[model samples]
Target: MTRSARRTRRTRRMLSVAGLGTAALLTLSACGSSDSDSDSGNDSGSASSSASADQKLTGKVTVFAAASLKESFTTLGKEFEKAHPGTEVTFNFGGSDSLAAGITGGAPADVFAAASPKTMKTVTDAGDASGDPVTFVRNQLEIATLPGNPDKVASLKDLTTNSDLKVVLCDKTVPCGGAAQKALDAGKLKLTPVSYEQDVKSALTKVELKEADAAVVYKTDVKAAGDKVEGVDFPESADAINDYPIALLKDAPNTAAAKAFIDLVRSDDGQKVLTAAGFRKP
Candidate 1:
């Protein structure tokens, strides 16, 4: 064989061996890297899970409450926030029925304080409440008139006699309205208000705005109004008393905080706040 041909053949053999070595090296590197990457990914996932699990109720608490509870509950929320240094509270105050609908629709809430047991029943019936509720306070309906008894609404029947007087009451779906109905029935007086509000707070607001001469709302709600409205006591109110029920929701994220808040409410300090706001103890 010629030296040139022999050299060429030897070169080809050397190149082939080099290529095979390169390929083996690459395959071995790929195999060695798989375990490290898998372990790294698993470690990252475990860290994320541990961080989430360690998160506590020191974060946030959301409360869905009735509109009538606006003034007092705001104070209570502030006190609760102060007592729990690491926690914060956000409130959603509105009509009881609307709050119930929101809860049933999956709105996040750690606590719920309804204006009436009937409203609380809706939550319980819908399975949104975490446990059985307890009646904390009883509210009675009153005639919210002008600041000085300008109309001199002597009795429940007198309200029906004045057709020109603009009066407001809550919608039938609300607890206040239901109690008002019972009261009106007890007095044998029929009244058709100019506007049917969604809650006691709205009814009181109507009178406060001077849009109505009178409105049927809770005495506590009227008391919360300050000089904006005047509350009149009537005999019918004795017959219609609304019970307010409060509870923690089943999906509460801050369950420990929620229970603590509830306990605070049932405590003497909480009762003092409610009573000061004109809510009668149960």
Candidate 2:
């Protein structure tokens, strides 16, 4: 072969080698791009998983509520526990005045449900509430008498006029007591009770146990007593309906769970439970 022909053959071999090297580089670049895309997708999925894990609720929520809320709050607490697998709902039910004192005194509660706005103010004034309290329900006073209404107590005045009837009233410091006094004032009547109890439930219990012929208490408490007592509605009670308020405590130990519980209490489902227990809507 001539020298020029040999050079031409060499040039062709060089061109072929360059072409192969370019193809290999392109292949590796394509593979690297695909791997980067796969890694990005995995990162996105991992972030979503982390976000979901962060939102899972777990822990205990302590609630300080009025005695009148026992039945309905207990039902709602159970529902809250069911909705959050790892959560627990605990309650301290008692007179609104006492519960307010407990919360304002740093009782380590996550929530406060009061029988009256006046009671709730004690906590709010002390800066113990996270936000402004919301009125969730209202309740009217009723005269609870022994089973079958042995005293024939038909109105608030009946308890006042029948000096021998043996009546019980809640202490004026509590919501029920304040409401009863309001009703009596509205009707311009006066009554001297055989005893002044600390809470509505205590007043109702007096009638249930036959310790008293009648007692001025909340409609809900009367309904809760079932066949243990009889309830008599009075026109004056309509003028003195107590507004119930609830709030999240400022230093709630379990904020997430506390918020969730409040949401449930204000929900339609919760309203049904309260209304069923004889509490009026707010």
Candidate 3:
């Protein structure tokens, strides 16, 4: 072969190799672009999902509840927090009347659960409730005494006629107190309490702490107190069955969460918890 021909052949082979390298580079670049687009698409999908989830109900919800509801509602609140991440439930438990007064007086609360419809009516009548309150449970009055009933108190008559027995009662302004008054009236009995407590829990606490020999309180309260107090059922108690009502406040800071909490309370699971706590079905 001529020297020039050999050089031409080498040049052709070099050009062929350079063309192959360019094609290889272009193929790698195309693969990289495809991978980049795929990753971008995946990232976009993930972001969309996160945004949708973020749109759900989130934030703090404040609940004003009756003292009798402390145990069951607290459990429901915890379950709510677990079911809806990033949400918190804060509760203020006290006498239904006082809570109603607070709401009517412009207290900032998302929800209200009153032990009686009358107390709830105080809120609804004052236009503090967003809608008509619904009754969720009923509670009956019972005599709570120190464990073992050492006072030998059996009925409402014993509370009225026995002066030596130290007895405590809820204030007439609260639901439990009102119920006690009704029961006493039904029995045509009048008893003077050593002290009038503001709420059923306080009255029960007096019995639990041995401050009082007996207290007129709700059956649920006595059950909650467990061994701390013994419960005595009187026939006159049938005259006063308190209905518990709940509603969303008109000026709820977290309406979504408040509604959700109410729904959970009315759900089957919530009913189970309340019934287990000794509250009767409404």
Candidate 4:
């Protein structure tokens, strides 16, 4: 072959090799871009799922509630747990004043439900509540008596006059006791109880257990006691009505779950439960 022809052939071969290399580089770049796009799409989907999971309520919610709310709140708590599959609800039921004391004293409770605004104020005053307390229900005082009117007790006056009948009253510190005192004062009646119980439930229990002939308690408590005790509605009881308030604590461990639980309590379903238990709507 001629020298010019040989050089031309070499040049043509070199050009073809360079073209192949360029094609290979382009193909690899395209593959890398495709993989990157796929990875970004996957990352976006994973992030969306993570965000959804974060929005769901999980973990435990601790509630400090009034003793009278035991039945209704327990039912509501079970319902809340069912609604939020992974959530747990634990309750501390006691006198409103005592629960207030616990919350003000730095109790680790996510929610606080008090029998009276006065009691709720204790927590709010301490800046422990996250928001303004909302009244959910109202309760009226009633005279709880024996199954049958064995002592012929008919009214508040009857309770005060009967010297032989054993009687129980809630201590003035609790909501029920405060209401009872107001009722008694409205009627201008006075009588010493055989015992001054800490909560309305305790006062009611005394009558149910036959430890006392009669006791002043909320209508809801009397109704909850079923056949264990009888309820009497007196005219004086109308003078005092206890307003029950509830709020989320400021230092809630599970703020999301705590808010959800509070929503459940204020919902129509919650109101139904409260009314069914003889509590008046607030």
Candidate 5:
């Protein structure tokens, strides 16, 4: 073949190859755009689900409650469940501060029933609660010791007088401990506890276990303990009372059930159960 003929044919082949390369680039660019659209659609779906979770109020109701309310609240919670057929009431009982932390850490909770208004204020301050809180019940402190009262803790003054006895108390952060401190301070008495319990239940349990001679725990807790420990009521205790407060959260998932439970607690019937367990009227 002639030289010019061969050169022309080679030039045409090179141009055809370039054209194919341009076509492949356009095809890849189109696929990339399609994938981008798919990702956007998936993100939209995920966002829709999250919005539904925030806007709808039907599922489970979570309550972060004080540890001392374990039994009475448990019974009350069961009643709440029975009253609302489609709803379930779940409880996370612990120290009020610990429960506050759990709720603040993104735990899915619907209500908070604290042993004190101070702890309930923690939630309101954080803008977690929905409305003005009301006191549901009041509880008083008492000295709980192993059955038979071997140490003879008949009076609050005796705690300071009897230095030999080992005593335990709920930490100052807890409602019961705060009440105990107030009662002691009012009496112008200063006594040291061997251990500062994290919660009232733990403080009462220490006495029940015979690990400590006595502990100032809630009267409701003493009644709940039932024979494991003997309760000693001193005169000064009449002055210091722990007020319990409860409310539905602003971000509640089951507001209907949460409000229902709150209503039940405020009802005449609910007050009966609480008063029966030694809680004072609000």
Candidate 6:
């Protein structure tokens, strides 16, 4: 019953306590390692998801664009199709108002490029647009005369007041027509047109076919017409430059392709095509 017996028992108790402490520490370390592995797995999944989100886009993208954009947008559409193989770009080019109506009426379209913000709003207000429309270009009014400008049309007033000349104008609901009206108002002049067309292309056609002497239209249209019609810039047109806006529709069948097309329209290459078509930067 002695010092040796007490010391051996005390030493045994200390060893047992240290063994339990070491076991507890190992258990906590195992749990921490498990949690770390779980966290690492979650991060990997997230990274994979992010990578998948950027997968290659392939589909048909239908675009409802203003009639004036037919030439330039057609060029862009071809470029888009080329850039994204296996993708097709289809366009519905008409009056901005008509195009807006189509989009709001449940016509399945991926993109909308209006000649003016007002037309774009018609789609946005109806919750048809996926996001705010961005203005990519601006267009000013000009007089589209016959090839060689035989009438010697000098200004907007010449088209407005020269009763001897049969002139065509776009409908008031059309962007080009509205801008022409604004320009006319700015000049404080008024004259009835021989005919009001549904779109800029139609109005320009009247001049191109010699159906009318001159037509008020976008400079881009005149430029697109090439030798088919001569363009005459007027000072009053500066006051009525229209801002062209583009947006992806909310119910777009091809959101990815639609967004990519919008990005292209805003890109430098797209701007170059537009500027070359005689459209000004927005």
Per-residue lDDT of model 4, residues 1-282, tens digit only: 999999999999999999999999999999999988887857675775466546789999999999999999999999999988999999999899999999989889999999999999989999999989999999999999999868878899999987998999999999999999999999999989989999888999899889999999999999999999988999999999999999999999999899889888998998999999999998
Report lDDT (CA) for all predictions. Answer: 0.87, 0.91, 0.92, 0.92, 0.86, 0.92
* Quality of model 3 by C-alpha lDDT: 0.92
Per-prediction tally of clashes: 0, 0, 0, 0, 0, 0
Per-residue lDDT tens digits for candidate 5, residues 113-224, read 9999888888888888899888899888888988999988898888889989999988998888888999998899998999998899999889888899999988899999
| lDDT of each residue in 79-108, candidate 2, tens digit only | 988978999999999999999988877799
- Candidate 6 Cα misplacement greater than 4 A, ranges: 1-54
The C-alpha stretches of model 5 lying farther than 4 A from their native spots are 1-58
Of the pair 2 and 4, which is ahead by TM-score?
2
lDDT of 3 at 184: 92
lDDT winner between 1 and 5, please give it.
1
Query: Model 4: clashing residue pairs?
Result: none
Query: At residue 38, what lDDT does model 4 achieve?
Result: 82
Candidate 5, residue 121: lDDT? 86
Better of 1 and 2 by TM-score: 2
Q: Where is the poorest 10-residue window by lDDT in model 5?
A: 49-58
lDDT of 4 at 263: 80
Better of 1 and 6 by lDDT: 6
- Cα lDDT for residue 261, candidate 1: 79
- True-structure RMSD, every candidate: 13.5, 8.7, 9.8, 8.8, 15.1, 8.6
